[model samples]
Target: MKLSTKELTESLRELILKGEFTSGEHMREIALAERFQVSRTPIRVALAANAKDGLLKYSRNRGYSVRSFDKRDIIDAFEMRSMLEGVASRVAAEQGMRLDAEQQARRACDVNDSLLLQNCEIDEASIEIWREQNQLFHSAILNQSGNRFMHEMMRIVQQIPAVYPPIIAPYRLQDLRLYNAQHRKILDCIIKRQGMRAEALMREHITGAGDIFCEAKPN
Candidate 1:
């Protein structure tokens, strides 16, 4: 019920990313304050911060509303993410991934493989597990990269709904398996200290999701 300013801001951000608030939906201070059980002052601060973070758009008279992103916006965000994640993968390979990080990535891939074997078609529950493992694999590499700037930039870019790992996981078995196989190749390249190959694979891996999402966009 009680949340610090940072917590409040992140909470609101998570709601936006999860599509709990639709694009172009307006947020009211009074309603949000009541919902979060916080004072209006903190709600105002949180709203302003989110607006600054590009999650909300502020108008002269209309206050703050969820920012509407067109297909181009999503595509551009994904492009940026692809570049940043590629760099992370390359750096992780050059630095030589830590033993613990390697273990984490390998375990994540193993779990994903098992999940795929168990489900011909991924259900909602299985999708959640898949997302968790996907995040684990990616994050392990990013953390091993040891680049704080890239990490911060990734946090910003991935705030876009479709660019987040959870949103990028495809429900279809064929597509999901394709992504998982790429993960294996990327990790193998990184472990072998092939920085260029790791970087290229990582870029393609992220870009593949972008292409799928853009193609699915309504005309």
Candidate 2:
């Protein structure tokens, strides 16, 4: 079976997210083509797309290398994300109307809430669910902001290391629980149409994660 460009790209993205490829590791088109058993064309397309997404950086003669993000970069990225996302929330609230996008955001929040209600035990699987729902909730608001530039900016910011799947691979159950709770709080604020509160909560939510990740020295 042949892999589509999207499939190849997503596979490579997961590998990158899982730290299968270390920071600054050079990627060769021919090597990836052989590894994925695909032609160089699709490999090239995947690489180019990922590069534009901020997962990889390109140089004139250096081909492509996984971008390395440090503590400072993560902190800075979250700072910007908070402001942009806050603006989105405010815009949604000021509009005084709940559109399909707002409902989608609520749905994502509900998913997270349901997962937390499980209360049995948290594990890698639970963490994956939380990450997906968390992103969906945030993306919902950003999309509703009706600001293409801000939405695109957040997408690029999210591609940074440590933004998705939050903690390091070997995360503790307690930490995961705590993170989920924080997400719930942010969602609560948004659902109540407390725009200012939601914005503040979101800023704290993102920056707090950055702080914890920095403290733990995940990278």
Candidate 3:
């Protein structure tokens, strides 16, 4: 079926992240169209968007190829992500969070608390569940930051590279208890309106998990 530009973009991005294409593999429009069961039009649009996301390289003559990320690249991504997310947390606290945003984030935390209370295991399905719930929590903070630029930068961070977050495809997975504890600490600080503490906790949480992810990745 023919997909819209946004649909094709998400489909192709997930495919790439799932390792369907090797690093530097040329994403020929015709080939991708065939693979995705679409046409060249959507493929072209999606590829362009992926290129802008830094997940693909585009050149005048060569078309698009998947960009390979190195250890340093991953490190840099987490560094930037931590700083950005920390800033978001701080902004949300200092500016006074919107009521709805606060409610949504609390809901996300509640979901996590329920899961952990049930003694969830580290399985594939559990990973997917955490990813979805955790994003809701983080997205709420980003939205409440009340800064359009920060929201845009966050998108860039998630899209620019394969983000193997703490509960996701971490290179070396962290203990869920520790990870969840950090999450709780962040939420606590935010709820308490401790702006700087929230910021520091967020930065520490991201960077600490990143260290595990990177150390497990091949050099």
Candidate 4:
């Protein structure tokens, strides 16, 4: 099948974030071209795009390798994410309130809760649905922030594999429940018009994920 640069980039991003490519693993153009059933040109374009996003490292001799992060690097990434997400939540509560935005966020949270609150084992299929809902919830808050610069920078930050735990590692059901609980708390502050609490909770919520990622098996 033919894959455009955008499609190939997304595909490669998913593979890297899912730990298919271990940290510091070299991405051979010919090998990736065969894996994605595309040509080297598109693979090159995809790798270049990911490098721009800071997900991959480039060197003249080695070409492209998946970027590696140590414990400190992970902490720093979360530190930045926490601040940015907190600001977004605060701004949303302060100036971007709208009935429709609230409704969308509520629906996303409800969907995620329904999936995560269950007692049954979490399968890959359900996990995928929950991931989409989680993204929706986060995106709603960012979109309502009314700061284009923050939104764009946060977009780039989210692309970093370590900053996105769910995509980077398969999470336990219990972990999913805990994360969703935090999401609800953040939403609660937003609904109650408590900007400071919402901001603080969002910061705490994201840092908690960073802790979990640190404990998880290194990719």
Candidate 5:
């Protein structure tokens, strides 16, 4: 099979998100090119693109390495996300004109319900599913805000190293359950047109997740 540079970039980005490639690890161009069965040109292009996306650090002479975010970076990222998202919620509410937003929010809630109903413990794959749905729900609300700056800021924040689901070896079912429950509550608030409540819930939800991520340190 063949892979495009964009596909290769996405594959490497996912590897970083899943913690397959740890921070400070150098990405050997030849090795990656050979492994992906592509030429070095695409590999270089992919690395450059990922670097621009803030997923990797590139130096003219030193090549590319995975960028690491410390605890403070994670906290700051969440803080910014919460503030922007809260504003987005308020804006959406004030406008009072978002049929598509309401639908997307409801669908996101339904997706979470399906996942939670499985009643299984949190695993890598399950966490990925939750992350995808959560992102969709948040994005839907932001899109409704009609603020291009807010959306662009969130797009950048989502690329941060610690923004994805934490890679805890012993997955915590309780944390997953609690987070999912919060998602349901937030959706309810949005559906009921309780804009302020929705904003507060989202802020707490993001900050709470940040706290949990910090506490669940790598083993």
Candidate 6:
């Protein structure tokens, strides 16, 4: 299928985060076009978009290459994201979530609950499904925050390596139910308008994920 520019960007970014492309490796438009089964135009635009997100470096003649980030860099970015997202949660709780946003979050949690019901075995397809729903839950909270700047900052921070929710593939094989539980608590806090508790829970949730990511990351 021909992917839109936004879809292409997201797909490429996810692959990059998953280590499909190594650090400092240059992405060739032709290769990506063939891989994604799309024309070079979308691939080109996607690469440029990722570059803007700081996931890739662009040079006049070098095109785009994956930017290398050590564990510290990733952890630091996640720290910032945690604080920003925590504030978002607090704001959303204080202001109250829209009916649609609350509904969307509940749906995402229910879908993930079903996914987590499987036995301890984890697969690529399952991970992909979980990632999608996880992103939906986070997006609902960010949107509900009613702060555009916070939302935009969360967007940029999440683009960092090992910081994006979809990058949780490394820890998925472990105790993902814990994360789901945290999600439920966060949702409950927002619904109950417990701003401080929601903020603290969100901070811990994000930092906990970061810790796991760093541990699993190769030295």
- Candidate with maximal TM-score: 1
Query: Model 5, range 112-183, lDDT digits (tens) per residue?
Result: 678867857766677778778877788888888888887778866766635234454433667666777887
Ranking by lDDT: 1, 6, 4, 3, 5, 2
Worst 10-residue lDDT window, candidate 5: 161-170
TM-scores, each model vs. reference:
0.91, 0.80, 0.86, 0.86, 0.84, 0.86
Worst 10 residues of 1 by lDDT: 162-171
lDDT of each: 0.86, 0.74, 0.78, 0.81, 0.76, 0.85
lDDT, model 1, position 125: 88
Q: Is candidate 5 or candidate 6 better by lDDT?
A: 6
Candidate 1 per-residue lDDT over residues 1-219, each given as its tens digit: 589999999898877876678778889999999889999998999999988888899998999998877778878888999999999999999999999999999999999999998898777788879888998999999999788988888887877744233364434688888888999999999999999999999999999878887776652
Q: Model 4: residues >4 Å from true position, as ranges?
A: 161-171, 217-219
Off by over 4 Å in 5: 1-4, 161-171
Give the residue spans of candidate 6 off by over 4 A. 1-11, 34-43, 163-166, 172-174
Candidate 6, residues 1-219, lDDT tens digits: the string is 677888889999878877687788989999888899998888889999989888899989989998878788888888998998899899889999999999999999999888889647767788878888998999999988777888778777776754333465568555688898899999999999999999999999999988888887775
What value of lDDT does candidate 1 attain over all alpha carbons? 0.86
Show the colliding residue pairs in model 2: none
Candidate 1 runs further than 4 Å off: 161-171
Q: Quick one: best lDDT, which candidate?
A: 1
